[model samples]
Target: MDTDAYTTMRFERRGQILTVFFRDPAEANTSDLAIHEEVGRLFHDLREEREARAIVLTGSGPAFFTGLKDPVGSLLWQREQGLPVIDAGRQVARRIVWDLLDVEIPLVAALNGDATGLGATIALFCDAIFMADTATVADPHVRIGVVAGDGGAAIWPMVMGPALAKRYLLTGDPVTASEAAHLGLVTHVCPVGEVLPAATAFARRLAAGAPLAVRYTKMAVNRLLKDTMAGAIEQGLAHELLTFTSEDMVEALTAARDGRTPAFHGR
Candidate 1:
């Protein structure tokens, strides 16, 4: 694959293992529409890269991923410009989840730091997750007046069951690495600074195994996720986009700008 073609992420290849680092550490790897679109396309490209037997995904800085960059501002801008936020959102959301699942190679997440909102969803979707002890994870879309769409509503429930998933998703609370492991949301929890090494080692081990067996096993297990995503993601993203136009969303953005708690009236 042409790694240079990517701008938001950097890729390094070591034998059959590919390590993908989310760039933009200055922004704590926060993703915008451009980054989201790039990520979706990257996964589709990975699916065709036969040389990469395993993939390790991690961030370049203190944050593994921090969700969207200025999502409220972006939404308001889209509204001001009379852009089709819903239409664009649906396409991006669907492509991200679908292309990620379509990758047959084993993918492992190295949670070097906090993973929130879309970040949490992507980390949890991996075949194995290695989270740093100091890192936290959450799907906190509701905190910003958005639904936990973008695979969060679908993947979180599958990872930790609907009951526990709702507890965090509804409140937009952060989960510690230990708590995440206990909930089966993480496969391993390493001390800070060791997450990537452990995850890479694990990925190498998987790469050494019979490639066909590993890939087929992952495909078989992912069937449940794909099915759940099919049923939930579209509706979740639709509702999320609808919330972008809500009065409550405007209030949320205003509160965030003023550094205060949002007073949501559920409008």
Candidate 2:
């Protein structure tokens, strides 16, 4: 695959197995606006990747993916500049999930470290997730004063069921690798430093499988996810956009910046 167009992510191909790394290790591979846009386009472009039969996605450093880069600051800046933050965010968020679902090849996630918010959602969307024993995952959009609308609301319930999904989503609590494994959230949990190797091995196995069978099977299974997303994504993102302009969101951002607890008054 020609991966020179991507900057936030690096790609390595070994035969038919491709490993894609989140490149900004110093920042824990947090997705900024550029990263978000690039990721969506990357997945969209992968539809034409005839060489790679399976892909392994992992981070370069101590995080699989953290979330957004300075989301609070970015939101504040957009508001101050009178930008149409909601429409812009809605477009990016929708494209990421849709493009990811459209990929025909299997996607395996190697959670090398903590994955929070949108990071957790992306991992959950994968065909299989291999997480480090020391790692944790959580969709904490609610904690940051927004709904878990960016594929989180749709995928979490499907992976862990509604009750268990609500427990995490409602509280924004992190689930340890062991806990996630027990709950059937992650496919495998490896010891520290082994996550990538384990995921790569699995992806190689997938790559060696009957290509048409594997691809078609994945397509069949993903139909359920697509249906759920079709139902929930629009409303979830719309609600999240509304929360961006909420008083509670502003207070949450301000309190986080000030190193204090936010006093939300349900505005």
lDDT of 1 by residue, 6-97 (tens): 87888899999999998753564544677777876888898888898999999987789774667667666655555475568667777878
lDDT, candidate 1, at 119: 83
CA displacement after TM-score superposition, residue 237 of candidate 1 (Å): 1.3
Count clashing residue pairs in model 2.
Answer: 0
Candidate 1 Cα misplacement greater than 4 A, ranges: 25-31
Q: How far out, in Å, is residue 120 in model 2?
A: 0.9
lDDT of 2 by residue, 1-267 (tens): 569988788889899998889865356444467777777687788878899899999998778987567777876775565537666877788888887887899999999999887788789989999999999999888876888888888888888899999999989999999999999999999997889999999999999999999999998888877986687888888888877777888888889899999998877
Q: lDDT per prediction?
A: 0.85, 0.85
Q: In candidate 2, residue 17 scores what lDDT?
A: 90
CA lDDT of 188 in candidate 1? 99
Question: Residue 15's C-alpha lDDT in candidate 2?
Answer: 91
Model 2 — TM-score against the truth? Answer: 0.95
